[model samples]
Target chain A: MQAAADLGAAAPSRRTEILDGLKITLPFMVGAAPFGVIFGALATSQPLHLSPFETMALSLFVFSGSAQFVAIALMAVATPAWVIWLVTFILNLRHTLYAATLVGYVRHLSLGWRFILSAGLTDETFAAMEDRYRRLGVHRNSHWAYLASIIGMHVNWNCWTMIGIAVGMQMKGLDGLGLEFAAIATFIGMVVQKLRTAGAQTAAAVAGILAALLAALPYKAGLTIATLVAIAVAVIFERHLERRGQA
Target chain B: MSVGIVILGMALINLVLRCPLFLVANHIRIPGIIEKALAHCPVAVLTAIIVPFALHLDQAPDGSQWLNPDLFATIAAVAASLLTRNLMATIAIGLGVAVSLRYLAVF
Candidate 1:
């Protein structure tokens, strides 16, 4: 009887974590909704001839927004399968960075928990989880929050993609409505709030300039290169500061 | 060459990249410097993604690139974010400015 009561007491806290996760993820969902619709709309049009089911399945399984759009553009040109695969891998290489950043906090979780959490590590989810973990530190209930975030985004993305596919089939120009700006705005909001330190600010400025300068690079390779270099710069700056302090 | 095969391959690639560290998180230790560097990953990666999109860098050199509504809206959004520190407010100001500018441009 006492054990049953304890389990009941613990359940609500987990529920609260999930609720909090959903709340935090709401803005990201709003941001992604248009992107998903645009993807769905684009995939069904032009030289690319994806069926609705194929379009939805891409979102359902691969679940990377930029990657899916890249694939669609390549497929329109009848780009070879191997090239598409290579590009997808390269485009998503940043996920490895995200996983690396988050591994320490989740190291204590079971294999199943880790697997589930890692599977949904998109940019928005990563931002949300990283913000939460950095601000609050990890606790026993943190995985529940991570789980809720991934699930919320996963469902929201797939549903919106389907809506886009449906709307694309019936309409002519839903993509022209400037809906994608929401995502850029959302990213700005997330990125600005986190630029609280000089080191972070310098890192962001370096990454932004390099990315813009190198934007002409093929297959979105510039993004990865810029991020890696910016992180290196920030690390070196910190080390310099440390040495100065010691002197 | 089926789309199904491509989708499966992409999914596998994503899984491989994301899962290995988590799957082995307890077994290995990251070096101190590398761990410290990873602390900067979010800002670096996110800013990289945002800059190209917000700046219209991918578009061909047109004199009007600097006059982009999206760029103005992004600047507005950044200011709103710094002032309010609220995500919804930032997006609202951004979209509001963007829509209004586009509407005026159309007329």
Candidate 2:
């Protein structure tokens, strides 16, 4: 009777673990949908005259919000292809940092999962998975859950791009009732969640102010430089605290 | 210059940024340097994104072409974020304020 009770309790926990991971991880798909809509709308306005298919494809292939924004903004002005490429590369250079952080966690996964997961890597996905891994050391199935979240985000974002393009095409002009507000709202929600900690709050504020001040740098390179500067400042402060052994 | 060159250059740069840490993790021991560097990544990246857009804003009441949407929205976003501690609410309010100000001809 005791053995049966233990087995019954253990059975539910295994199911609960997977369920909990998916619950938090799945919302990113909804959160990411607005960006896709914005992208599709913007892409249609570009000189390239991208069809919905093309716009969706770009979302799937690039999958980087900042990079896609930079690409389309450059394309709008008929900027040289090489220059556009360079700008996108610089904007996305930070992904390497994420890739490095994740390596320690995903090192034991099969090569196939590694490649697929690598392709789906994004800031949000990495942070979500990192927090989980840091909390409860890596587990074999955790990668699967992480991958599920990534794939979920990828599909929703791309498919929503199609939806946005369709809406953008049909609507003459959305006045007052702005569906576009969804993305902004979503971003705010996510940002609020991230700001619960003092360190996170401080880091976000410093970075934002620095970025604003450096907005005019050539090639929009100021943005990238501002990020580096803020990071340097944050790191210095963190080191000071570490010296005191605070964190 | 050429498409191939552009692709190659971008790919190489991406590779350089992404893979170095993994290749060397087992090799040499570093003391908190990587962690510190990683810590900066988000702040650096976000700042790079926001600063230009924020500074370009010039919101003034006169039709004298003052007030930038980007800058105003950012200010509102930040203020809302800090005050409410609610990202979604802050962003919505910020965007709303910016667009409203734009429509009403107010900075």
Give me the candidate number with maximum lDDT: 1
Instruction: Give a tens-digit lDDT track for model 2, residues B1-107.
Output: 34334334445555455555544433334346656565545444544444433443212212233245555666677678778775456756876876676677654
Residue range B21-72, candidate 1, lDDT tens digits: 8998854555768666766776787787677766666564222375677878
Question: What class would a CAPRI assessor give candidate 2's docking?
Answer: acceptable
**Model 2 vs truth, CA RMSD:** 7.1
> Looking at model 1 chain A, which ten-residue stretch has the lowest summed lDDT?
A1-10
Chain B TM-score (each prediction, in order): 0.70, 0.59
List DockQ, one per candidate, in order.
0.45, 0.31
Over A161-182, each residue of candidate 1 has an lDDT whose tens digit, in order, gives: 9988886686444444454566
User: Going through the candidates in order, what fraction of the true interface contacts does each contain?
Assistant: 0.73, 0.33
Model 1's TM-score against the true structure: 0.64
CA-lDDT, candidates in order: 0.78, 0.58
